[model samples]
Target: MIINAFILFLSVALPGLLLTRMKSFSQKRIGYFLVFAGAYLFSMTVIHIIPDLFLSEEDPFKLGLYILIGFFLQKILENFSNGVEHGHVHSHGGYSIPYLLIALGLHSFLEGSIMTDSIHSNHRPDSVYSHGSSPKILLGIVMHKIPAALALMALLVAQLKNTKKAVLLLLVFALASPLGLFFSEFFGHSDVLPERYLVIFFAVVAGSFLQISTTIFIESDPHHKLNWKRFSISILGALAAVAAQIGF
Candidate 1:
C-alpha cells in the first residue's frame, strides 16, 4: 500500500516539478500525451473496472446510475478545477486559489479512496501484489496525473509568482490522493461496512474516468479535424491498456 501510494504521489508531482524547469514543455506536446493517457484510462475503465463492478450482486442498473452521478460529480469538480484533470491550464486572471485547490483535492481524494488494498484483495484473491492485481486502475490514474500535475503547476506558478508557494501547493495536491487511500483503509476495516459498498465506490470512480477520458479525446484537438498521429497514439494507448489487462 505504501509503495502504491508513493508511486501515485510521484506520478502527480514529479512531472510538474521537472517540467517547470525544462521551459520547453509545450502545451501541444502535453495534448498529445493527454490523448494517449485519456484513451488508456477509457479502455481500462471499460475493459477492466466496469466489468469487475458487475461481478457484484448489486443491481447493474443502480450501479450504472451511480456511474452517472460520478460523471456529473466530476463535471461539477471541473467547473472549480478549471478542467485541470483533463490538462486544461486556466488563463483567466484572478482565479480563487482556495476554491481550485479544494476542488482538486476532493477529486484526488475520491480517486485515492477507490484504490483500497482491501478492496483489491477482495477482488483479486490470487494476485501476488499486496493490493491485488488492480495495477491497471492505478496505472491509469498515474498516466492521467502526469499531464494534470503539469498543467496545475503551470497555472499555480503563473498565479502565485512564487516557486516556493507553487511547490507547496503541488505538495498539497500530491498528498491528497495518498491521504485518501489511507483514510479509506482506516475506515474500511470496520465490521458495519458492506462489501458491496466498495463496488459502488468503484462504479462512481469509473464514471468519473469516463467523463475525463472522453473530454480529453474531444478537447485535445479543438479543430475537429483528422490527425493520424493523434489517432495512432490513441490506439496505442488502448493497446497498452489491453496489454496491461493481459500481462498484469
Candidate 2:
C-alpha cells in the first residue's frame, strides 16, 4: 500500500513539476490531449462499470437505484466543481480552493475504494489476476492525475503568490488518493457498505467518471483545428483507457 501510494504520488507530482518548467496553455495540442484523456475516462467507465455492477449480483431495481443515486450526487459535485474531475478546470468564479480540493478528494477516495474492492473481489480466488482493476486503475490514475494536479497547482499559483502555500496545496492534492484508499479499506471490513450499497457506491463513481468526460469534451473550444499529432495522442489515450478496461 505504501509503495503503491508513493508511486502514485511520484508519477503525478514529478511530471507536474517538470511540466511546471514549461509555460502552460490550453492550446490545440492540449485540446487533443484533453479530449483523448476524456475519451479514456469514458472508455474506462463503459469497460469496467457494468462488470463491477453485475459482480455484486444484486437485484436489478436495487442496482438501478444505486446507479441513479450516483448520477445525482455526481451532478451535484459538478455544480460546485464546474466539472474539474472531468479534467476541465473552471476559474471564472471566486476561488473556492478548499471546496474544489474537497470535491477532488472525494473523487480520489472513490477511486481508492475501487482499488480496494477490485483487489479483494471475493468472487475470484486468485486475488491478483492478469487483468483486474487493482493494477490497471492504479496505472490509469497515475497516468492522468499528474496533469490534473499540475492544473490545480497552476490555478492556485495564478490566484495567490505564495509558493509555500501552493506547494502545500499540491501536497494535499497528492494525498487524496491514498487517503481514499485508507478509508475505503476501513469501510470494507466495517460492514458499513453491504454488497447492495457497494454496487451503488461504485456506480456513483462510474457516473462521476462519465460526468467528467462529458464536461471535458463539451467545455473544449472547437475553434482549434484537428491535426495529426492531436489525432494520434487522442487515439493513444483512448486505446490506453480501453486496454485498461479490457485487460483489467
Candidate 3:
C-alpha cells in the first residue's frame, strides 16, 4: 500500500515540477491529452466501477444514493478548486490562494480514498480473477494529475513571488491524495469499518469520476463541432478501459 501511495504521490507532484522547467510545453497540447484521460476515466467508471458496485444485490439503491452524494460533493469542491481537477486553471490575480489549496487538497484526498477497495481486494485470494475496479484507474488519475499539476503550478507561480514557496505549496497539494490513501488503507485493515462501507465509498468515488469525465468531454470542445482527432482519442480511451478489464 505504501508503495502504491508513493507512486501516486509522484504522479501528483512530479509533472508540475517538470512543467516548471519545460518552458516550451504548451497547455493547448496538454489539453488534447487531457481529453484522452477524461474519456478513459469516464469509460472505466461506467464499464467497471459502476457495474461492480451495482452487482451487490444487497441495498443496490443505497449505492446509487451514495454515488449521487459524491457527484454533488465534487460540484461543491469545484467552487473552491476553480475546476482544477479537470485541468481548468487560470492566471487571474484575484483568487484566494488558501481557498484554492484547500479545495484541491480535499478533492485529492477523496480521490485517494477510492483506492481502498482495490487494496482490500489485493489481499483476497479469490479476488485474483474477480471482476473489480482495475489499478488502471490509478493510471487515469495520474494522467489527469499531470495536467492538473501543471495548471496548479502555473497558478502558484503567477500568484507567489517566491519560487520555493510556490513549489512548497504545490508539494502540499500533491501530498493530499497519498495521505488520504494511506489513512484509508490503515483504517481499512484495522477492521474498524465493515467491507460494505468501503463498497459504498467506492461508489461515491465513481460518482465523482462520472461528473468530472462528462464535464471534460462536454467542455473540451465548446463549439460542439465534430473533431476526428479527439473523437478517435476518446474511442481509444474507451477501448483501453475495456482492454484493462481483460487483463491487459
Candidate 4:
C-alpha cells in the first residue's frame, strides 16, 4: 500500500509540473487537452478497472447495479461540475477552483479505492504483486490528472504567471488519488471491507467514467446522435468493465 501511494503521488505530480509549460495556447487547445485526458482515463478504466472487477468474486447482477449506480452518482457530479470534466472550463465566479479541487480529490481517491480494494480482497502475502492496484491505479490517477492539470496549469499560467503556485496546485491535484488509495488500503485491512460496499464503490467508478465520457460528447457535439461508432465503443467499454469484474 505504501508503494502504491508513492507511485500514485509521482504519477499525479509529474503531469502537474509538465502542465506549467502550456501557457500560451488558446482555449481550443485547453479543450483539446481535456478531451485527450478524458479519452485516456476512459480507456484505462475500460481496460483496467472493469477487468479487476471481473476477476474478483463479484456477481453479474451486482456489477450491473454498480454500473447504474455509478451512472447516477457521476451525473450528480457532472451537474455540480458544470461539465468541467468534459473540457469546458466555465468558472463559477472563482468558486470553480476550490470546488473543482475538492471534487477531483474525491474522484481520485475513489479510483484509488478501487485499486487498493482489489489488492486486499484478492492478494495474500505470498501472492504476486500482480493483484495490487498500486500500478494500475497509478496509471489511472496519472491519466485522470492530465485534463484537470492541463486546464489548471493553463489558467494559472495565463493569469498567475507563477510556476511555483501552478506546481503547488498541481501537487495538490495529484494527491487526491493517492489519498483515496490510502483510505481504500486502510479500510480493506480493517477486515471491514464489505462486499456490498465495494459493489457500490465500483458502481460509482464505472458511473463516473460513463458520465464524464458522455458529457464530453454532449458538450463537444450535442447534435451528435449515438451512431454505431459511439455505441460500439461504449459496448466495448462496458464489456471491458464486465470482464474486469469477474477476474478475467
Candidate 5:
C-alpha cells in the first residue's frame, strides 16, 4: 500500500514538479501517451476488473446498472472538470477551480479505493498480483496520471498564473488516489463498510474507467483522421495489459 501511494504520488508530482520549471510543453506527445494509457486502462477493465466483479454471485443486471451509473457519473463530473481526467484541457472561462477539483478528486479517490488489495483477492485468485489491483490496473492509473499531471499543471498555470501555487495544488491532486486506496483498505479491515459494498464500489469505478478510456480514444481523433502512430501505441498498450493479465 505504501509503495502504491509513493509511486502514485511520484507519477504526478514528479512530472508536475518538472513542468513547473518549464516554459512550454508538448501536448502532442502527451496526447500519444494518453492514448496508450487509455488503451491499457480500457483493456484492464475489460479483461480483469469486470470479470472479477462478475465472479461474485451478485445480480449481474444490478452490477451492470451500477456500472452504467458510474459511466455517466464520470460524464457529469466532466461537465465540471472540463474532461481533465482524460487529458482534455479547456480555457478556464468562468469555470470554478473548486468545482473541477471536487469532481476530479472524487474520481481520483474512487480509483484509489478499488486498489485495496484484499477487496479483490477472492475474485482474482488467478492473478499473479493477488494483492491489490492487478498490475495492469495500477499501471493504467500511473500511465494516465503522468499525462494527467502534465495537462493539470498547464490548466492550473493558465488559471492560477503562478507555478508555485499550481504545484501546491497539484500535490493535493496527487494524494487523492492514494488516500482512496488507503481509506478503502481501512474501511475493509475495520468492517466500516461491508465487503459486498466494496465490490459494488469496484463496479462503479469500472464504469468510470470505461468512460475515461473511451473518451481518450474519441477525443484523440475528433476529425476521424487515422493516426497510425497513436494506433500502434494503443495496440502496444493493449498487449501490455494482456501480458499483465496472463501474469507475464
Candidate 6:
C-alpha cells in the first residue's frame, strides 16, 4: 500500500515537476494523450469495472442511481476545475485556486478510493478477477494523471506567476490520490466502510470514469468527424486495457 500510494503520488508529482524544467506544455500533444487515456478509461470501465460493480452490488437499480450521481457529480467538479481533468486547463483572472484544487482533488481522491483488492467481490475460486478494477488500473490513472499534471502546472505557473509557488501548490494537489488510497484502505481494514458501501464507492468512481472519458471523446472532436489518427490511437488504448485485463 505504501508503494502504491507513492506511485500514485508520483503520477501527479513527477509530471508537474517536469513542467518546471520545460518552457511550456504542448497542448497538441496533450490532446492526443487525453484521447488515448479517454479510450482506456472508457474501455476499462465498460469491461472490468461495470462487471465488477454488478457482481458485488445486489440492487442493480440502486447501483445505477449512484452511478448517475457520480456522472453528474463530475460535471459539477468541472465547473470549478475548468476541465482540468480533461487536460484543458485555462486561467481566468478571477478564478479561485482553492476551488480548482478541491474540484480536481475530489476526482483524484475517488480514483484512488477504488483500489481495495477484491474487498467486496465474492468471486468464485476459478475466477481470476477482482472488484473495483484490475491492478493495471494504476496504469490508466498514471496515463491520465501525467497530462493533467502538466496542464495543472501550466495553469498554476500562469496564475501564480512563480514557479516555486506553483510547484508548491502542485504538491498539495499531488497528495490527493495517495491520501485517498491511504484513507480508504485504512478505513476498509478497520471496518469503517462496510462491504456494501465499498461497492457503492466503486460504482460511483466508475460513473465518474464514464463521464471523464466520454467528455474527452466529445470535446476532442468538436466537429463530430472521425480523425483516422485519433481513431487508431483510441483502438490502441482500448487494446491496452484489454491487455491489462488478460495479463498481457
Best by TM-score: 6
TM-scores for all candidates: the values are 0.91, 0.80, 0.90, 0.68, 0.93, 0.94
Which of 1 and 4 is ahead in lDDT? 1
- The candidate, 2 or 3, that scores higher on TM-score is 3
In candidate 5, residue 92 scores what lDDT? 43
109-174 per-residue lDDT for model 3 (tens digits): 878877665434533345423434437768888887888888888878877967688889988888
TM value for model 1? 0.91
Which stretches of model 1 miss by more than 4 angstroms? 120-131
Per-residue CA lDDT of model 6 for 57-76, tens digit only, reads 45999889989988999999
Model 4 agreement with the true structure over 148-214: per-residue lDDT tens digits = 5656555555546677886787787767777777776666666687755665676678767767765
Off by over 4 Å in 2: 23-26, 91-93, 118-120, 124-131, 189-193, 221-236, 245-248
- The CA lDDT of each predicted structure is 0.83, 0.65, 0.78, 0.60, 0.84, 0.83
Which segments of candidate 3 are over 4 A away from where they belong?
91-93, 118-134
Error of 6 at 205 (Å): 0.8
| Candidate 6 vs. true structure, TM-score | 0.94
What tens digits encode model 2's per-residue C-alpha lDDT throughout 114-199? Answer: 66653245544552232356666676666557557666667667766776687777776777787767766667667767755655
**Clashing residue pair totals per candidate (backbone < 3 A):** 0, 2, 0, 17, 1, 0
Candidate 4 accuracy as TM-score = 0.68
Candidate 2 lDDT score at position 214: 62
- Model 2, residue 183: distance off in Å is 1.8
**Candidate 5 — which residues are off by over 4 angstroms?**
124-134
lDDT winner between candidates 3 and 6: 6
- Could you report the Cα RMSD, in angstroms, for every candidate shown? 2.4, 3.5, 2.4, 5.3, 1.9, 1.8
Instruction: After the best TM-score superposition of candidate 6, give how far the Cα of residue 18 lies from its true spot, in angstroms.
Output: 0.8
Ranking by TM-score: 6, 5, 1, 3, 2, 4
